[model samples]
Target: MNLFRLDASILPGASTSAEIADAAEAEWAAAHPDGTVTRRHIGTGFFPSDAWTLATTAGFTPEADHSPAQREAVALGVALAEELRGADAAILAVPLYNFGVSQHFKIWTDLVIAGGGPATPLLKDTPTLLVTTLGGGYGPGTPREGWDHSTPYLERILADVWGADLTVVKRELTLAATTPGMEDLKDLAEQARTRALDAARAAGRALAGV
Candidate 1:
């Protein structure tokens, strides 16, 4: 089996999201030691900001009129689309930044859409695990209630748009352990992390068909 894993964490070494994803991936690895895994780390290796625009415009412009950059962007978009289409399963680790999806992930999503066509379902019927982390609480009654604009959009894309059998693993209050004002919430954060990691492992096992 082949697994496609994408991570968008600017601080990978200290990323709560990555830690959650690693727990999930470890299960998969244990189950399928011989399986192939494809990885893309957008946070560390950013794509050109204009790649999506160039790719989208290339579709409208004649082939002969396409610039070299546009051509490359188009190829990149197609490659990204193929990566999703070809995967047996997928794990996407995307942390909320500035209260929403990071710019790096947004660009990647746009490029995939541009390449796969706006309505295409690249991950149709595929099992997908989405791991998202937030620095603060966003649940009901919290000060940041409804402030999480990332999870819904992610669900729309992975489950609704891409047609994946999606499993979401979310960890919130990630900053509590380190942020000065959140010392009181550290225990709660640890609890959340433990729960998320457990869920992630279960999801990973499911993905491995174990």
Candidate 2:
């Protein structure tokens, strides 16, 4: 079985988001030691979000092109699409920054899943795992929880565009008022990693018809 892990941790060294992703990946690997694991760290270098112009002929051209980084965007889009095609399952681990997913994650999402036309869902309807971490007071049932844009947005994009059936695990309030006294976020990272790994294993088993 093959699994793709999208690690969007800004602080690769000490990032809770990355740790959570690690949990999922680790479990999956342990269950299926022979399975292939593909990791894409979008935090470091990823596609920049493109604002394609609305051309009169339904096709973009040199004159209609506005973003100076179109070349990079196209290259990144191709790479991302290829990666998606190669994986049977995917795990996206990202932290909520300012009530939304990080720009890195957003940019990647926009590039890979923004194709048009009916046959556009070339990478849709797959099984997906999403792990998101928030700063504080944004746990599951909080009043302001709805303000958290990461979960809702991700779900919509993956389901509607990518056609993915998803399992979402969110670790909230890693550093908040009500959930104070938290010193570090490494444990959270570890836990997330384990969870991701487990998910991968489950997916493998199902694929094997076991």
Candidate 3:
């Protein structure tokens, strides 16, 4: 079995998303002790900002006329797409950044689409776990209600577009414990964290088919 995990948290040391993902991964690992694991950390291993553009343009140009950069970009897109298609299961740890998807993740997703074609179901029927974290709450009745713009897009890409058998574990108010003026929300943040972690473990087991 093979498990592909992608982490897109810029703060590796203090990423709530990663922490929740860790809980999920640990469960998966326990179930698949001999399984191979593949990792991609876009937060640290960033793609070239222009790579997507080059890859997109290369699709329109003949292979014989492709520039060196375009060829490389095309190869990268294909490789990224292959990672998802090849995986038996996948875990994506992505955090809300500035109320939306970060540039690093956006670039990676675009490159994957460029390589796989918009209609391709790269993860068809694959069990996948999506763990997303938010520093602040944006639920109904919150001051920032309707402000979260990352989760839906991620769901669309991973589940709707890729055709993955998806499970999402979300943790909100992640910064309540540390952010000023959020002292009152710390307890709620902890509760959210605990719930998310528990959900992650269960999802991981399901991903492992255990």
For candidate 3, write residues 17-61 as lDDT tens digits: 999999989999999999988999999998988999999999999
For model 1, residues 1-210, the per-residue Cα lDDT tens digits are: 899999999998988889989999999999999999999999999998789989998999999999999999999999999999999999999999998888888999999998898889999989899999999999999999999999999999999889999999999999997799999999999999999999999999998989
Whole-model alpha-carbon lDDT for candidate 1: 0.93
| TM-score ranking of the models | 3, 1, 2
Order of models, best lDDT first: 3, 1, 2
Tens-digit lDDT track for model 2 on 1-210? 888888887878977777666666666666667989778898886543343222112235563563445554555565676787777777788888888878887766656643333235644756677777777555558568578878788877766767766777776655643344654655764564466456545643443334
Backbone N/Cα/C clashes per model: 0, 22, 0
- In TM-score terms, candidate 3 sits at 0.99
Model 1 misplaced stretches (Cα beyond 4 Å): none
In model 2, which regions exceed 4 Å deviation? 46-59, 62-72, 114-119, 139-143, 176-210
How high is the CA lDDT of each candidate model? 0.93, 0.65, 0.95
Best by lDDT: 3
Alpha-carbon shift of residue 67 in model 3 (angstroms): 0.7
